[model samples]
Target: MSAGRVAVAALFVVALVLFAAVEIASRREGSRVPSLGDVCGVVMRYRVGPLPVGRIAMFGFWWWLGWHFLAR
Candidate 1:
């Protein structure tokens, strides 16, 4: 594999590890770390004027991801 691909894969692995660690920590008793759902809930609660900015932003993110990785 090329060095660039290797670097990107390593970064993706690190992100997954960090996410798993945080998720586990959030589940432990008396731990302060928030679960991913909690964070997303808080973010999605925000609004801009009449629009749900957080929700729109999330939709945009998912759309972008799908377009880039799933589209042929």
Candidate 2:
């Protein structure tokens, strides 16, 4: 796969692993962490592109930050 496809696959895997770990941990330990569905919903909403330049730039930054901080 190309770099972009690899990156996207990695992101999908990471999100699934994180969601599973957090969900199990929260249930077993009685913590207050958010559910996987809710978190994924929020993330999907934020991933949508925009109609304006500034909005697109901001969304680009948001996308950058997610990969920068979350991806290994």
Candidate 3:
């Protein structure tokens, strides 16, 4: 494999490890760390001028992600 591909794969592995660590930490009893769902809930509860800005932003992000990555 090319060096660039190796680097990207290493980064992806590192991210997965970090995510797992955070999730495990959040699951501990009385842990102050928030899980992914808690963070998403907070984001989804945000609003702007009677509009659900957080949901809109999330949708936009998914759309953009799909357009750039999946629509190729």
Task: Report lDDT (Cα) of residue 19, candidate 1.
Answer: 99
The collision pairs in model 2 are: none
Residue-wise lDDT of candidate 2 within 1-72, one digit each (tens)? 799999999999999898789888767656788776666556555633554554566678789999987998
TM-score of 1: 0.89
Which runs of model 1 end up more than 4 angstroms from their true locations?
Answer: none
User: What would the TM-scores of all predictions be?
Assistant: 0.89, 0.42, 0.83
lDDT, candidates in the order shown: 0.93, 0.74, 0.94
TM-score of 3: 0.83
- Give the C-alpha miss distance for residue 21 in model 1, angstroms: 0.6
Query: Model 3 off-target regions past 4 Å?
Result: 67-69
| lDDT by residue (tens digit), candidate 1, 1-72 | 899999999999999999999999999999999999999998888898999999998889889989987997
* Ordering by TM-score: 1, 3, 2
lDDT of 3 by residue, 1-72 (tens): 999989998998999999999999999999999998999899889998899999998899889989976998
